[model samples]
Target: MSEPKSYIQVLSPELLGRVFDAYAHKPDEEKHLIGLETTLFSSCESGFYANPVILSHVSKNWRNISLDRPTLWSTMIMVRPIASHIPKVENWLERSKTAPLTLQIMQTIPDDDTPIEPLREERTAVNTILEMLLKHIERWEAITFFLCIGFLPAFAEFPQGKLDQLKSATLNLATWSTHPQVVDRVFRAIHAAPELEFVSWCASFFQTGLPDHVPWQQLKRIELDVNDISEEPSSVGYVLDILSKCPQLTSAKFILGFCKTTTPKALNTPLNLPNLRSLALDEASSPNIAYVLQNLTLPSLHTLNLSLFSDEERSSANLFKAVGSLVGRSKSTLKYLGLDIDDEQLLKLLPFAKDVEVLRVGGAKTKKFTSLLTRNANNKISLEVLPKLEYLHLTYAQDAMRPHRISASTAALNRMVVFRTSQPPATPGLKKLKFISVGTAASSFQTAHITLILGTYSHLNLKSVRFEGN
Candidate 1:
């Protein structure tokens, strides 16, 4: 034991810190950790540990090395900070030194379904931590809030216009009230941050116009998930007005639920976003989604995701047509398209997305998906549509209208694969395919079927084929 030694023990502090930094900030793991505050909070008090804490516990030398590295402690995730953890929070701040901080503050009531007001002692501890951080506001790189209605007043005590280093902010508000005035005040305070470039807001229930004093023109990214966005004419107008103001935006996402009406005044003038590159719309009504698309001219757009959630059979066709029209308008630049639509809508829009390199289609449509891959009455492959398509992802839902059609779709898909593979040089064909199905039955093509299909097209160099089912 006395003679035992490891190679890592010989590394310099700088080199060890670099290794620890990489281990602590694995990009994908950090992304997963960002929205998982509950898990982090629970683990904080558990014997299981991660990151700087674990590194410090390894040995005396390692502990000194970990403490000397500021990057390892710059991010502080405060999820329901308790009075007992004040000393720990203070120690973390002290160790962080002057490194730019990314703070995520989420206050959730522990072990209680009923909403009770925050205890005075808990408020005092939160204020103490916030007051300490406020002294170094210039080091704030990003701040996120997952606050309940009751904690909003406590958050309002921060001094104004102090975020010189701030670049991003996220607000996730969970409140039963229809009108959350605190949301407006929060945005007002955010507006005071001159360097803020990205903002994401998720309000469980929001019923108000855009807050005043937002630096809309300077923002490069925006995300909004609000209920009843298109319920009122005024709300729709405000949304459109905000979009019009943000000419520098390169990416945007929206989730508007239960849109029952339209705003004619908002749609009167089209919004031109020449710089936008990525747009994602989720659970939006046909009219509302089309209204937003019709008004935008996305010359730089390359990625588009339209996850439609409408039950109106007749209106869905119109929505699909509008989307097709929008794609036609963006044909010069569009390259990636993800759609959740039925086969009929897919057929209607396929021509517009001929140039799309990557395509993902799902939601009760895969049953009829093979029909699109088949040759019409003619004996030739339908390479005219999606000639540039390199990647295809198909998802099968168990409750498709015609589950019996699965076999037919599978047959058609096999034929399409064979015919496309057998084509002469200069003809582009499918390079990769991903099949994911959710059903009790064998909804996706079985391994044997795939092997048989590939055997017939052995000469074709298929890049990859993945099959997943549940």
Candidate 2:
């Protein structure tokens, strides 16, 4: 009898080719594929079967089809590249032909016990890899680098206008010392790229602040994360200055370290962002966060996220008031709001954003907020707070300082969900709640209770209900 045919041998070439293409572009949470040399490494946790390079070795027919598809080889992720992989990199680039390339060059972060110095051979390998990539600069569509500051000089050699196809770039430069001159030169090279629109710049603090030569007018999205370890933290005024230059930005995020105290003269006038739609500010003191909210006028803002790590209660009170005033002054119809604040502060800020459709909060105590959402003694939803809220996400904040603090009880959550979902369709200005996600301690909420809630609400046509345990 003839041997039985395997799955690969029985499938048609066209169907197999489509499968190969889909696997090549599938998103991986870990992005564990080391590079083009997939056979030399293995990720025991995620498995190597997801790598597209593995398909070529399955059979002769599969190899022929893989070689014929150029786009399948366009994306290359190099993690701690070495000299031995040079030939594989060349072969991969050659196979991509003229297709646009998406590259991610990363290095393993060293722990405290590990040496910070790069091995002599590793430096040679990195330099050679970058040199090869520069030869095809015109085909770069998106590139991300998580490397040391020493590599910034290599990018200064990029010819102007050679990055016409580049639309996105992420520079995560890290080192113990600052290099303002090198950083400035790199920014100058980036400014010459006319097609660049999205950028994420993360680095340690620089005394000179952000470069002024960037193509800010052409950018639509930007994220700046500056970790300040110096005696004087960067000022919010400097960040506002950068935003003033970007008139075309629709989304912006600023994650600064400790912020310097703001004086009345810091912001002489209110800055207007007529086109911005989304903004997020994180890790600043309460006063600094309030300072930012007080000086900005976002007429088109729809989504906002604010997080503070300050311990001053008075400043937090001021921050809440500032938020309410900003929303009221802009008269913008906010659709989404996220806050890492307490229940009282959240309640005070929600009234100004009554049109918000989604609300996310992180706090140790949310009983009061959930009660406000539940039907009152008259069996009616509150018209004054979040009348149009459709989705609610609550994250339990486990602070070591307040170990006895309790989160929203399971009973409170169930009642709130039932009340919001049971609202009559004829109710004016009130929308039925469709989704709820709760993240709390495992002991507080059990899987059986969640199952019971799902069984009870299944008839209400709710979209989804999720529970995550810590």
All predictions: root-mean-square deviation over Cα?
Answer: 6.3, 5.7
lDDT of 2 by residue, 226-309 (tens): 453234666777678779989988998887546666634546677888889999987666676777888888989999987665
Where is model 1 poorest over a 10-residue stretch in terms of lDDT? 39-48
Model 1 stretches with alpha carbons more than 4 Å out: 1-19, 27-50, 59-65, 78-85, 109-112, 115-129, 152-154, 173-185, 204-208, 226-238, 263-269, 312-314, 319-321, 327-331, 373-381, 390-470
CA lDDT, every prediction? 0.63, 0.68
- Among these predictions, the greatest lDDT belongs to 2
1-470, model 1: which lDDT tens digit per residue? 58867889788889999888876654422223333234342212111134468789989999999999988888776666667656766777788898998876666644456445554455566667777777777888888766553453455555567777889988765452433555565566677788889977665335544555778899999887655332353333445667788999999887655444664544554567888889987766556677777777777888888776644422453665666656667554678888765456667777667668777765554535666654443534465666566666655444433221234444566766555444444544533333222222234434554454445544556666554432
Off by over 4 Å in 2: 1-50, 54-69, 82-88, 115-124, 149-160, 176-182, 204-207, 226-231, 266-269, 310-314, 376-384, 396-406, 439-460, 467-470
Residue 185, model 2: Cα distance from true site in angstroms: 3.2
Clashes of 1: 0
lDDT, candidate 1, at 47: 14
